[model samples]
Target: MSIKKNRLSQNGIYGPLTQKTLRNLLKKELITNFGFENMHIIADILIDRFLKIISECSVEKERIKPYQTIVFAVDRNQRFGYGKTMSQTKLIPVTVNIITHQELEELASGKYLKDLRPKIVTRILKEAYAQGGVLSLNDVAIICGVPNTIIKKAMRDYYKQHPDEILPHIGTIFDCGATMTHKRIIIKLYLSGLLTKEISEKTNHHPFNVDSYISSFEQVRGLYEEGKGVQQIAFFTGFSQSLVKEYIQIIKELNQLQNNNKPNGLMSLTS
Candidate 1:
């Protein structure tokens, strides 16, 4: 019987078999050796054992030193062995280079850094700004294979040196703490529906700061609906009573305008 050769090697004694052929051969062997009834159970046991062996081999392979090579001989005709007798076997020597995860990362990073040029950094920043005004230092560092600290320093230095060009692209810059505090106050008062007094007390911030934080929303009628007087709203929101009353009046006027702007037919339908 002529044996089929594997694509990897023409003269090897045992070549790789296709998944379908291997399965069919295993099924036939199990049926002949253990009968039809016991075939599936025996095959399952064999498969589980083979999988365990494969997992162990994978772990051992990982434990091997990086760049270390292992040479081994494989018998190609082992599948044709029958009843203590073996067919003419050919031994093929194979060499495998072992590489650890860290080694692979280092090699990949080296290649990335080698390919990256000074102009590429500027282009990366430009692309980042085009996508969004904000760019992540860690993301850019990962792409360029540089440390985040180095990337941040380089960006800050570049922006300072060329503010005319870089500042316009990057957009407004504010202290992170101040920006976060401003957002937190707005979210607490508006989205969270917390009282201005509650936000001021919790944040230990001035009432004026809270009012300024929520000024962007341009409305404050909910404070009045909550049964808070103008004085109380001013105390909590950091706005003067006059400002609070003014804001409430503005909100009322805006509501009245919206009501008047509705078509008479739609207003009648709702009524």
Candidate 2:
């Protein structure tokens, strides 16, 4: 049958167009929610969300029909590049069924949003592990809001760079593979102050958090103009107490270093 023009609200089923639109809308909401600065990246978020929803539905009791073809739109700015937009080469697609409105609503809800955080984290971790052997604690904090404690605990006994290189634990319908570089990149981006949601959009790895090959930042400017401590900043940032302290220390140190580097005294006997 011709692809339906709109989402099947009465029956609660979604067609390709409906699915695409929902993906876009959901991404827009997520971008706003995360306070990301760009709109072009909406496409990235849409793609990532599409993969996640499909992956979850594919294996669950409510199976969705397998799509014969999938399309990914190219960004005008093309942050990654024309070649990066090609999913066949850059991304490894997993099988999944179409999603229902009920499921979508559940995920989109305010309460369920936090639960999905790890999934986004997982996706970036995949890339990081592939690119490098290890990822930093600060990196994990940015993408998933996962505290460094969880990352450290997860890394127990495993190689620091390639810990849990092959596992499928997040909100996916199936297993996937990741490398050390991928995990490292995830951590790097997190430390660089890029949120998982934003990176997901940028990387075109929709539904990024997966139980694939493996598992695995930043300066604290101010305390929201309020008299809050590490806990408050951590709460707002989804970081651990130790991480918050570390970032504050780093920023303070950098400032101090810069001040110290300034010319201590004016030169004398200048012509």
Candidate 3:
């Protein structure tokens, strides 16, 4: 560390990255890099104006308070996706800002709009998930002051419009036994020709999970194409009958869509 940074770390009240500490660092950088005689004066004027104008962003001119909460979620780094059992997966507390003051203001303005609730639900889901927090539908329902059904509808709509992007939620993240939703999303991405890592990042799923889902899909594909029943495929692949049925259903849907678009070919969803 530099001599100046060493002092700040030892004595600064809010650590070395607070607004005041950063302002001093910027001023020093200006003086050192440009070798200007009056750079201190210029830096003070610019930095002060910046801090003042940015602080005015809040309508009350007070600090804006984000709607934040902490929840426990699977530690992404600790996950051993696909073949490994998830019993050893560790859960860690993640602090998330559900919505910013600015976003709340926007939603408050659209109170009477029919789509307002759905929009609010999706926004909160995305923000919390982006921060590595997985919220349940019930959690969102409470936050939105609505029924769980409303949250479910919003999630369904979000997936319909953005099938390539999976919303990280409790069920999707730490799904242990049942893999209905995650399986469908992963299989859809695989059938569309996305590689394992690409599908993992796009769907916000662990790569191990992606690989496992692909393997299960391939296991069922041949038997179904050969006119075998769901039970037959399940018996052959050792997957649950429900999973076998899901794979077959998705295969039919994707094949039909692919056939319909044969003239122009499927559009690249990666874009």
Q: Pick by TM-score: which candidate is best? A: 3
Q: Order of candidates by lDDT, top first?
A: 3, 1, 2
Off by over 4 Å in 2: 1-219, 224-227, 263-271
Write one digit per residue (lDDT tens) for candidate 2, span 1-271.
3345343453466344556675667666667776654765765856687778576434443432432212222221222322332453233323221233444577767546444434433544454434322223444554345686665455432334444243222211111222333343443344345666764544434333411211213223456234568888888877677656755554454445446665533111111
* Candidate 2 backbone overlaps, count: 36
- Model 3, span 115-159: residue lDDT tens: 555566777666666756566678788776678987888777777
Against the reference, the lDDT scores of all candidates come to: 0.46, 0.42, 0.67
- Candidate whose lDDT is highest: 3
Candidate 1, position 31, lDDT = 79
TM-score of each: 0.22, 0.20, 0.62
Runs with alpha carbons beyond 4 Å of true place in candidate 3: 1-66, 80-89, 176-182, 263-271
Ranking the candidates on TM-score from highest down gives 3, 1, 2
The candidate with the higher TM-score, 1 or 3, is: 3
Whole-structure CA lDDT of model 3: 0.67
